[model samples]
Target: MQAVDVQDYARRLMEAHGDKAVAEAAQKARALEEKGKHEDAQPWRRIEAALKEMLGPHQS
Candidate 1:
């Protein structure tokens, strides 16, 4: 995913899931990966990374 899309999705997810947004994004990525959907999981992985960055090292 593009950086802008990742940030946008991460922001929306954070708003929806609050503190659990990272976990939610991770779960989505893992689920797709486990199902042999690596391509599909890429965006979620990006979002997960973006969410982690947004949270910062001191947060999560």
Candidate 2:
């Protein structure tokens, strides 16, 4: 088997167990964006996006 990048593995693990975190981060991202604090919301948005991707297209 190929060696897994540790950081990537950890990220995947977080994504696997991330439903609540994803929801909260997404909510925060939306709120910040609405407030014109897009820059501040960038990381949260990225996190929400990545975790949602991990959850796949079937997720609600």
Candidate 3:
């Protein structure tokens, strides 16, 4: 998806679940990464990365 789509999804997800969604997703992604399961972590990692990328370095 495009940056715009990522931005929209992040916004909507935040609105629906507050900060918990992003926080939990990031946590899950990290757990996977630490286990060397990058492929399995992709979905969560991508969303977290996209949100951060779209929001910039100071986002979180």
Candidate 4:
């Protein structure tokens, strides 16, 4: 639905599953995007993007 909804869902998912969840979701979204499943990945991509923006750059 809305971007806010996607962000909220992402936050909840992240809280339940931690960082791995975001990584897995992002990977899935990328795979879907490569397959031209843009519609399918829309929510995931939004969630990933929002999470990244909120978390800032990751350092290892």
- The candidate scoring highest on TM-score is 1
**Deviation from native of the Cα of residue 35 in model 3, angstroms:** 1.3
Query: What lDDT, from 0 to 1, does candidate 2 have?
Result: 0.66
**What TM-score, over all chains together, does every model reach?**
0.91, 0.57, 0.52, 0.72
Q: Lowest summed-lDDT stretch of 10 residues in model 2?
A: 1-10
Query: Where does the lowest 10-residue lDDT sum fall in candidate 4?
Result: 16-25
Error of 4 at 43 (Å): 1.4
Q: Which candidate ranks first by lDDT, i.e. highest?
A: 1
lDDT of 1 by residue, 1-60 (tens): 688988998999999999999999999999999999999999999899899899889834
Expressed as tens digits, the lDDT of each residue in 1-60 for candidate 4 is 698798888788788878776796799899999999999998888888877776778789
Each model's C-alpha lDDT? 0.93, 0.66, 0.72, 0.83
Model 4 misplacement above 4 A? none
TM-score for candidate 3: 0.52
Error of 3 at 13 (Å): 4.8
Report the C-alpha displacement of residue 11, candidate 1, in angstroms.
0.4
Q: Could you tell me the lDDT of residue 27 within candidate 1?
A: 98
Worst 10 residues of 3 by lDDT: 51-60
The local lDDT score (0 to 100) that residue 34 gets in candidate 2 is 99
In model 2, state the lDDT of residue 12: 64
